[model samples]
Target: MTATPHLNTEHPKHNLTGFIIFLCSESVIFLAFFSGFALLKTAALNWLPPGVEGLEWRTPLLNTVVLISSSGTIWLAERCMSKGNLMGFRAFWLLTMALGAYFLYGQAVEWSGLQFGFTSGVFGGTFYLLTGFHGLHVATGVFLMGLMLVKSFIPQNYAGGEQGVQATSLFWHFVDVIWIILFVLLYVWQRS
Candidate 1:
């Protein structure tokens, strides 16, 4: 008689822990860039490059609103998922992805109108490095959410995928939080 091997069906805690650690590492990278920008701003007499005036506020502010709103939508999606409401989860998840996409589009449009390039100087280099890195994260979050949404269509997948949804939500929230800081630093603080 052959013995059957036991499989652990419970959700593993290490997956979430590993993801948190990864986020912490990412946080350190962002902090380094922020610190560099602050140091440069304080040391330099001319913060903005020669031809550039100051960053325009309107579009970026609107983008910030959209990106921040995504945090709420993703939260609702996670809540719905925990309660086993798949339809509600799908709706909110879709909304979150849409908001992320809109923010990315707004950022690209703003970049297109900029007077300076990444090679301009310290301000330009830091500005593109910070925003571009954050934008990459935003794009990643959106892509992950897209995969999650597709997997959600299968009923069996829904029950097994809660951890994935939570991880994606956490990542999305991190992206949103980072954007809030970047918006204040790049747009608001530079002006004053």
Candidate 2:
């Protein structure tokens, strides 16, 4: 019999580099949207549609705090996973998911109370487009975290699933960072 060829057994512990490239591509799309918003803000004489004063910051600021806190909780989960603390990982991971869900709920409440719709004008269109897109990403992150939590129940997955864990954490962190930028653009800067 011919000798078997040696197999490559070495593999990366995580696909962080690939994931980062993916995030970069996502950043391009968000950058385009933000650029469009800035252009409209500068060119339009009346940034707020007639009769619309401006957005209230209270609810959104609270939601921002909740969403930003998720980044910390997720980071803690990653730290726990790296240290072989599965229980800690699960606890923090679940907490992160809860925070994301709360943010989504808060967004929904705010959207419901809005006096405008997508067809209202440029202000309304951009507002819904940006926040809705970001909200979708947050929902996706929560769903992924739920899957990871279910997988964590399996001991085999816990021992050898660092790549998935790391990728999810990276995605969650990227979403949080994007929200920060969006919050500044849509809420703080526009109001000013």
Candidate 3:
């Protein structure tokens, strides 16, 4: 059997040391945003939007389940990739993408139903800022997952699927984790 070319090539799968550093920097940025949010949250005591009372948690909560389930599917996809089961990897990856789409759709519906727009007040602004950035990250995860699916089909990109899957999973998990904090801060902890 001819030896396959190095899958990671110049990327992190071949050398994750640098990838960890990149992840750390990303952590720093998000931490700063979270800190700013904490500071602003106190100022919301008087100005907090009452429209939040009308917010429906069911749909958003369901979306949270979608993300958590997608994380599971990603683990299976990684398993399939390790077994060199390309079709299995592709299928699970598609399921994960679909779940991600469902989560975004839920977000759109939730936002549409909100009485306050993004600029309505400090609450609206920060709410959008936190969730909007999270949505962007989810969008990026979808694209990255799609990239892995495409690469899975191309024999040339075969070796890198594992790396792609792991990186995508990392981003996905981070998105979920951030949302957990966001949910607590917005829905539970910060309640007046």
TM-scores for all candidates? 0.92, 0.90, 0.86
Runs in model 1 lying further than 4 Å from the true structure: 1-12
**lDDT (C-alpha) at residue 168 in model 3:** 77
Candidate 1: worst-modelled 10 consecutive residues by lDDT: 1-10
lDDT of 1 at 21: 90
For candidate 1, what is the lDDT?
Answer: 0.91
Cα RMSD to the true fold for all candidates? 3.4, 3.7, 5.0
lDDT per residue for candidate 1 within 131-174, as digits (tens), equals: 99999999999999999999898769865547788889999999
- For model 1, name the residue pairs that clash: none
Per-model C-alpha lDDT, please?
A: 0.91, 0.91, 0.79
Best by TM-score: 1
Candidate 3 lDDT:
0.79
Clashing pairs in model 3? none
Q: 1 or 3, which is superior by TM-score?
A: 1
